[model samples]
Target: MWADKSYTEVTFKGCRPTEPASNFDKSVDIQLYTAGFGDKVGPLKHFTKCFELSTSTATWTGLPKGLYYFKIVKIGGESHELKKIDVDQVRVDTTLAD
Candidate 1:
């Protein structure tokens, strides 16, 4: 999601894959970064921060306004997989307040 103005917080709704069975017992990491940075040479070079969600919904605060992107990673060792978020099941909301 792109934020035209700085926001104190962003709300991320819980999401499930189209094929829930594929998730199994894996836990995924929700990572945030600047736009066009998530796929750079070094994945962590443009890293911002990581979020841990205890519930279906999560709110991350104190982020600067700008173009941004998210990376969903399935937790595992060296073989961890990068998962794509199901846009249909997920909702990202940022304050429209100016």
Candidate 2:
């Protein structure tokens, strides 16, 4: 997802109970990247302040918007204990500052 303007904060909720269940059972590192309004994404620019499977939520603040995407790292357990979750299990939502 892309934000049109700078945002004070952004939040990511990890799982969707409504969606089909998967073998997701571990904390993950949410890798955030940007492309400066272009299609090419830059290197690993930031990580969420907190990443946990227990809470199923991730967040980062002070983000300048253009184009962005998230990569969930260390799926399953920290050492990749559990099986990989379905691709459908991942979801992204964004709200720009008013």
Candidate 3:
């Protein structure tokens, strides 16, 4: 979703991938970066912090605003990411769960 405001209520609903290799796990390290090419939304250029959620209960406590593009970094020394996307949302459920 595209926005033109510095403040926005981004709801990280979660993700449900059919393939198990594309699911967001608990050890995933998401890296959020503002789209530096799209008019520059805010002064914030890097990720402020990271968040952790349960795969069973779909809920987000606190997600940062002013973020444009974000990537999920695979943890647990995995070769590939379980799931990755270019948005300000987080995954609440995995393929195996749902």
Best-matching candidate per TM-score: 1
The candidate 3 region of ten consecutive residues with least summed lDDT is 52-61
Q: After superposition, how far is residue 70 of candidate 1 from its true place, in Å?
A: 0.7
Question: What stretches of model 3 exceed 4 Å from their correct place?
Answer: 7-26, 36-67, 77-98
RMSD (Cα, Å) for all candidates, in order, is: 6.9, 6.9, 10.5
Tell me the TM-score of each prediction against the true structure: 0.48, 0.45, 0.31
lDDT of each: 0.42, 0.43, 0.34
lDDT of 3: 0.34
Q: List the residue pairs that clash in candidate 2.
A: 14-56
How well is each residue in 54-88 modelled by candidate 2, as lDDT tens digits?
23434445565566766554444443233343332
Model 1 residue runs over 4 Å out of place are 8-23, 39-55, 75-88, 96-98
lDDT of candidate 2 at residue 88, scale 0 to 100: 27
Q: Which stretches of candidate 2 lie over 4 Å from their true place?
A: 8-25, 36-55, 77-83, 87-89, 96-98
Predicted model with the maximum lDDT:
2
lDDT of 1: 0.42
lDDT of 3 at 91: 40
TM-score of 3: 0.31
